[model samples]
Target: MAEWDIRKLQILRTLRDRGTVTATAEALHMTPSAVSQQLTNLSRQLGVELLQAHGRRVRLTDAARLVLRHAEAVFEQLERADAELAAHARGDAGEVRVGAFSTAVSALVVPAVTTLRNTHPAITVRVREAEAQEAYELLQAGEVDLALSLAAHAPTAADPRFTRVPLLADPLDVALPQDHPLASAEEPRLADLAAEPWIYGSSGPWSDITRAACEAAGFRPHQAHAAAGWTAILAMVEAGMGVALVPRMAAVPRDGVVMRELRADRPARHVVAAVRTGAGEGGAVGRVLEALRRAAGAPAHEPPLPGPARPPGCPVGG
Candidate 1:
């Protein structure tokens, strides 16, 4: 059996095109001696005289020409392979796993997925609902390709292990019971509600945002109730248990809950899409990130409709 080295073949091809050892060496960034040594080794390996001297220049022999012809085909095939790989990386056809928190899933991820399905059907997106910490864990573990999280919970931009792409600054609005004194206020001042008992998330990013916003308004909230999910928190507000701060992304107009924009101390969560360092550039991940940015920027008059029926084993949440 005969063996051929692709690197050596490449050197030979360069030599044939350049028509001189010196020119070939210059083209390949090799010393002339090194280029000659490679050609000598390739000739010995192939058992053929691949070059012939013609005065001050060298030319490919008939045997060398035959091999070069085949080498050209091999080069073309390799180029085609590279192009296909790039297409796959660009999400032309492949799967992207995403992890996101619930509101982000409803606000950003689902709309991005729907857009991808329409625009790039060959790319499949699998989603899982996870909180900020859980989403980061899933991303680090390689369980998901992208994570949507509050920027406060995401790693800093200087972190070399991940790329954080900002999607939106989702403002926190005041959720008041319809009959509350300030419910109809065009722009209720946060400081004015400093004495109001507040409903807040029991823990996690939402709770952190709530506490921080209240503190910025010059007082710690009188946390009347702690609930985990937005639905429950909103329900509590609707029942007049207490007022609450709701992120714009999670706000839903309900019968008894009136949402009012804050006049001052307008706190907002920065939402960002995160990926493993270098993963978000020019691939399916990049495409999905773009879709998310578009979805986040567009007005959301209503929450996303329920996503298409889930296939068995499909994870849901964000």
Candidate 2:
């Protein structure tokens, strides 16, 4: 069939609705002969019988019925496009599809979304939680507009295809059971955790890093549970099934679980926002990125107040 036109599709739909040319013309404010001519033109273009008259009424051919269904959907899509365009023009609405890795979702994504709501309040933000690598792929495929990624270190600007924004460096921490021997040890070394059954997150960059940390400690960890995310790992730790090394920001202590610094020599990994070259700027995605930046820039921990000091010659405030 030749490419369809909006007017022809609308006329076919009107005929289907009004059941005849005369009634369709009355509804559309067009003459019956004009509507019939348009239908004939459409039938000629498609090389098919689109309609047939029966006594005082007209009905669609099977092919015409099928095409009309698709036409109805196309018109609905056009209407949606119009509504979305109007919303965009007014800056009152737009949809942003965002992807974030598991840890980032728990640690920063929620707060970031809250920040977005408080700041823009007009944009509709949809989030998909996935592993970092998967999320990156989704961003690359245009399935998502922005991805929250974790990098063990800063990324080199070798690829201009994406604009990488540094958000925060979230440090790693060791999760242990509440009463585990290592849990009570202040500044526990990585070696202290070696012999314990380790619960690792399912295979990923972070898992590699965790294993590397264990290998550096000179003992292979006993893999007890392989969980999906920090919460699962922590749940295992709380159940006293195994220990895990997790990002400090996302490894909040739960009942029966304890979190301590990793005390490793490696620098913290950065949680970053990755956007396709030209996709995320100056829209809902941009606003969301700003909100995430604000959340990631939040202080790691509250500083403690210092105790009062005594003068060199004075007795202590005793």
Q: How much is the lDDT of residue 233 in candidate 1?
A: 88
lDDT of 2: 0.68
**Candidate 2 residue-wise lDDT, 1-318, digit = tens:** 376878987788778756779888876789999999999999988788999888887899999988876775675466446545644785745677888876677667788778778777787778898766677667644578777876532223543335667666666677788999888886787787767888885576666767776776787877777876666778888999988777666666698988887655442566667775444445566667777777877442222111112111101000
**What lDDT score goes with residue 184 in model 2?**
86
lDDT of each: 0.75, 0.68
Residue by residue across 1-318, what tens digits does model 1's lDDT show? 446878899889778656789988876789999998998898889899988989988788999888877776675465445445766666377778999988899888989989988988887899999877789877765689888886666765434346677667777788999999998776688888888989986766667767777777788998889987778988999999999888888888899999998856656777777776556655576678788888988442222211122222111121
TM-score of 2: 0.59
By lDDT, the best candidate is 1
- Candidate 1, residue 275: how far the Cα is off, in Å: 1.0
TM-score of candidate 1 on Cα atoms, chains taken together = 0.66
Best by TM-score: 1
Worst lDDT run of 10 residues, candidate 2, spans 309-318
Work out the TM-score per prediction: 0.66, 0.59
